[model samples]
Target chain A: MKNLLFFIFIHVSLFAHGVATGDQGYIQQINGINFVPFMYLGAKHMVTGYDHILFLVGVIFFLYRLRDIGIYVTLFAIGHSSTLIFGVFADIHINAYIIDAIIGLSVVYKALDNLGAYQQWFGMQPNTKITTLIFGLFHGFGLATKIIEFDMDPNGLLTNLIAFNVGVEIGQLLALSAILILISYWRKQPSFITYSYSTNIVLMILGFMLTGNQLIGYFNS
Target chain B: MFNAQQPTEKDLPTSAQLLKSTIIAILVTIILLVMVILPAEYGTDPTGVGKLLGLKEMGDIKMSLLEESQNELSQENNTSSIDSDSLDKAMVNNTINNDVVEITIEPGKAIEIKLEIKSGSLVQYEWKTIKGGLNYNLHGDGYKGSQKFISYKKGRMVQSDSGELQAEFDGYHGWFWRNREEFSVTVILQTSGDYIQIKQML
Candidate 1:
């Protein structure tokens, strides 16, 4: 429980300042380095990003093998990165709020899937891989909006965005390490099976918390 | 729920060890909450500037860039070639600046606000009234014809805290209001045909 509280405090602390999702204004162009600051900011944002963490929590909740976790995460990485790169480059803009709300919904979807809600209710399973790939696209586009928002310089945008994407991958690795460690250990304890349901329930609560906040901010604005 | 073996009794930590871990986690949580609720120490800090947190990204980060560069640069320049495109994207986004609230001291539209506030205030801080009810511009295109945030103050600010004094002020239609501080403020023009106005006091 303490560990859980500790993890949440870190997340809540980062988001309390500004919205947690990535966007342009989050990066400031200091000293005319232009996209460099954004690239650096992207690295930082991903390391501490809670929404990304939440999605990750759902993604890796059931995996027991490192290789399996890697495969799933890679799929997600490809999904978002492809969209993040192409979406901004193509100038396909969507309402950030709505996109974010959907991103929140993605979290909800994953948590529900973890709890086997889809099977109990839907009878037929949705294509998990396809859904992950699709949601990854939404997440990437979401960050791309922020990158686009930053008024990223074209001169080195490709380089910097690539750097940012790399940084995101790095951050994801680090975040996943901690999460995997926790989940792996929890699976050992006798209580692991008993608490799995509640853990995902907490994940659902966290997802709803995120969606609720974004919706309110969307409407208020 | 099968994975690597957890530290069992044979390899388990002592009773004191488990107790120590539990205590440490609790202590750490308390310390973090304090850091969050309290203000940062006086120093040049970039609460205004966010910390770059995304470090562990995909491998061969630079290689990916090289590959994409050729594909994209030849595909035609990216859409975000100009500052104007950014403004257009801003128009479609309808989220408040969840950072800090504001109250404009002027009587014109505020396009973008850049404010660096002193921290240590509750997330419940507000803009006191100085006149009639405060009115604000949500976000709109500025004279620059960009969808930059253009907001006027609206309604009044009410501060709810344990003991901090929440001053009441008469607000006009030109203030940005938020409780969280240590941020930059940007307001877009509320009306057309008028330039952004600035007052002596903010």
Candidate 2:
């Protein structure tokens, strides 16, 4: 419960800062040491992003082995990285809300996988590796959309991008580590097995919530 | 199908293996992602505006000799990408300022059409279940918030349930359907001359 409270606090605070008005033209002065700050910002965004964490949780939920986790995550990473770097670097203009809604649904997808919804409901197992990879591409594209919102300069593009990428990696590691710790401890409790089912249910609810919010936003205003 | 025998423990991953594999998976995924994204970032502009505006092939002994003169003007400004035709259009009609449209099309081919609105001047190309009638139809994007001339009825505005295609604007950009196929797009603006120039690339 304490952990849950802490998680909620982190989520609210992060969003308060991360959710900026959708004007892409706001130019802030980036210091010449471009790599560090941007990278830090990228990393911080990943670490503190609740939306990202929900998806990550779903990605790892069913995997009992590291190899499975690796394959799926790698697929996601590939999809996102390709789109993110390429999208922003290439300056592809995308709608922020629509992409985000898809991103929200990606979380639901993983949660559904965890719950064996596909197998039970449809009587088939989806190619988890491929789906993750495809969804990862969408996720990466969303990130790219956010980054492109910044009027990035041509100078030191590689270095700065590298820094930001590294920051993301660090943030992912941190978030994953914390999740591992919590889940590991939870797994020891009597309710762990029962909670596993609930975990996915909650995840799915959150995904629906996210998607619903984005869509309503799309139509409204 | 009620009760099948469960798999044995020998089939499941050992705890040690699980831990090792998870760590390695995270590392491998991150490395591969970065590797894929980095190169595409450093390369050409993804927005492809320069293509839409015909900036790259500006200075040729083509059509009106506007290309050569525009190239000289663009060179003075250190801009390697700005269409000569687009400049002329801008001088004539500037509906939206500070917007440049780049289009990719086959050489020496540009579509010309004049649009006259009986009601309001917004025009859109949309899809219909009955082909021509407005029973169940998709609209927006190239339609530019234009009306379909439905008698005394406000143009229908409904959110999509099937996720058919997201709301789109601009003929060359946004979600569109020639026959119900979705294409992600990047639209640049020209705003004059020949109403709009559309270049579709998958």
The interface root-mean-square deviation of each model, in the order shown, is 16.7, 19.4
Span of 10 residues, lowest total lDDT, candidate 1 chain A = A23-32
lDDT of 2: 0.49
Candidate 1, after superposition: displacement of residue A185 in Å?
Answer: 1.8
Candidate 2 C-alpha RMSD relative to the actual structure: 18.8
Best prediction by TM-score: 1
Which residues of candidate 2, in runs, are more than 4 Å off? A1-27, A31-33, B1-202
Worst 10 residues of 1 chain B by lDDT: B163-172
Share of native interface contacts recovered by each model: 0.00, 0.01
lDDT of 1 by residue, A4-106 (tens): 9677544432222121212321221111233434444565567667888899889888776567678889999999899989988998888788788888888
> Which digits, one per residue and each the tens of the lDDT, describe model 1 over residues B90-198?
3464232333333333332212232211121111223333333222212122222222332322222223211121112111112333321123333222221112122
Quote the positional error of residue A96 for candidate 1 in Å. Answer: 1.8
DockQ of candidate 2 (2 decimals): 0.02
